[model samples]
Target: MSRDLFRQAAKERQTLFNAWLMLNNPLALELAGEAGWDCVTLDQQHGAGGNETLLACLTAAKAAGLPAIVRVANNDPGLVGRALDAGAQGIMCPLINNVEEAEAFVRAVKYPPRGLRSWGPYRAKIGYSGDYFTEANDFTIACPQVETKGALDQLDEILSLEGVDMVCFGPNDLSVALTGRLDIWAKEVQEAMTEVLKKAREKSVMTLIFCNDADFAKPRIEEGWDIVAVGTDAGWLSSAAEATRAAVSPGS
Candidate 1:
């Protein structure tokens, strides 16, 4: 479980409260950590900015004692390797379908012998502790998000992979993929997501759920998800502002 952040959280703490960061700002990242979140997952796919922002936030995460994770849009080796080199403790790539994709994604995060990732920890060495090269192979986490129907089809094989540390279920994308519409609460999507949890449990793998808010996340965490990155920094900020404005404005 130590090698798997989600599992570690599930075992030590019931479930990890993660801030899904859509903003590239370091201050926001620091505040999330200060808010007592177990970790932060920087959203590179739908989030703003690029590699530069990732490096900056990863540094901030280190100072805040919050382990940083990056959610890549696709399974690109360069992106995966770069995130690791920049000191991300975990890498969550979306739309990973089948064993080959899972295997390739894992290889990009792992080092020599175990994987093909080049030897480079420009920020990892400084942010992470004690001989990174030796410990990285075991310390880094590989979490592939199961979103599409294709991924759901190959869930078992993906879970059984040697390098997969955890499995993340993306309800937003899966909702559309499963029902041809965006409704995370749709019966079809819910059933598919439930199947993912069931299979992961059977394989002894940890699971994470990408949720929009606490209400959505609560059920998943209770249903066996180890961690839930509920809502992005942008969503939280905007929602708070709207709520405050509504309370101050005239209402009956």
Candidate 2:
């Protein structure tokens, strides 16, 4: 199948479940793929994932029949190109706070006439079939994150830009941007997020969000997010470990 599976799913109004791959362990990656996650985001922004590890994980994802998107640490063209070249079906750029940043993000993801991304897909081509050059534009997801008050300020213009298939919301920073804390459930945060969801829907732009668990994720899916990505594998492992330890600890 082509990478457009995710694209088609979004267009059909399906609420896709995306797992956040934080750990670089191949076993963990394979397990996540087998666990029935529709797709995954290789977290290079905050997690320990780097270029080499991301490449391996992408390859593993292909083997598992999973489509993947890489959340780059920053919105640099080189970072974007390398991730795509390494076979990430898409790229989720962070800190997209304006028209220029949004434009640049798309520019690096598409080919000429659409954008200026150079040609190179040695690693990506191994697993993909057909025309990588032409089809890549349509299949590859270009999700620019809508976080920060600055981004929210120009949300309309950013959302209206070409090549922006979806807008990923980062509630942690958005919560801080709206309120002065990291609470994703704050009234201001909800209002802003709801507004974004509404506007994005009206513009025919898909929406994705980052949440800590199913409790938070389910609501956003109900709120009409095209995709809702939940906790990282490492974070889940940590939480489960702590819970298990606390449950059997003498402090009970």
Candidate 3:
């Protein structure tokens, strides 16, 4: 965890923490890394700003010795390609529903021969590696998310996509897809998530869970989910702010 930036070295298991820097705060991202997280995913989907912010966040991750991953806005090959070129060690594509979509997602993250991502290893990734393009592809991780009812149904096939290194479960979106609820611990949503983990184990792929608490992460970890991201940077800040408000306001 301390040594490797990307958690790619682990074949059977690993734990990655999400930076979820929705506010594009580099200090928050640095704090997450310093707190001993394996890696941080820059939440591009449902996040503010654009590539400029992403570049700064990636720089912070590198400086902290934590690999930075980008959860891309969509499954757009061009966007995915640019994110990688910007020096993101990992790329997470959201709402992947089936093998075809998974295939396309993989294609966007990987370079030619393995994919059609076009050549741009000369970017941040290489710069950090001391101009080492010889083994750049091996270090890049491509994560395609399984977040909808449709995607859950095709979990096995989605996991089968070649260049995809991990499957991150978007619990909030998945809950809406399952029972139309966004609450963190919705029952139907939990059941659906368990099933997704079970199938992910069967396919021999790494699993990343999105949860707000360590308690919520237990079942997923027991189910062999490789990495669990507790919450977003925004949520952490909001929770802290609320706790401070309660402590100072009319307490018993």
Which regions of candidate 1 deviate over 4 angstroms?
Answer: 1-7, 250-252
Per-model TM against the reference:
0.93, 0.94, 0.88
* Worst ten in a row by lDDT for model 2: 1-10
What lDDT is reached at residue 126 by model 3?
42
**How does each model score on lDDT?**
0.84, 0.86, 0.75
Query: What is the per-residue lDDT of model 2 for residues 1-252, given as tens digits with 9 covering 90 to 100?
Result: 464767688778888888887786667878887888888888899878578888888888888887888999998999999999999878999988898899999999998889988999878777566788888887777899988888999999998998988899999998988889989999998898888999998888888899988789888877778888888898879998999999999979
Candidate 3: segments with Cα more than 4 A from true spot: 1-9, 127-134, 183-187, 250-252
- Candidate order by lDDT, decreasing, is 2, 1, 3
> What is the number of backbone collisions in each predicted candidate, taken in the order shown?
0, 0, 0
Residues 205-236, candidate 3: write the lDDT tens digits: 66777887778877665665677787778888
lDDT of 1 by residue, 1-252 (tens): 123455566666477888889886899999988888888899899899898888889888888888778998789999999998998888999888788899999999999888999997887877354678878877888999899888888888899988888888888889898889999999988898889888887887777788987788888777757777888889989999999898899871
Q: Deviation in angstroms for 8 in model 3?
A: 5.1
Top candidate when judged by TM-score against the true structure: 2
The lDDT, on a scale of 0 to 1, for candidate 2 is 0.86
TM-score of model number 2 = 0.94
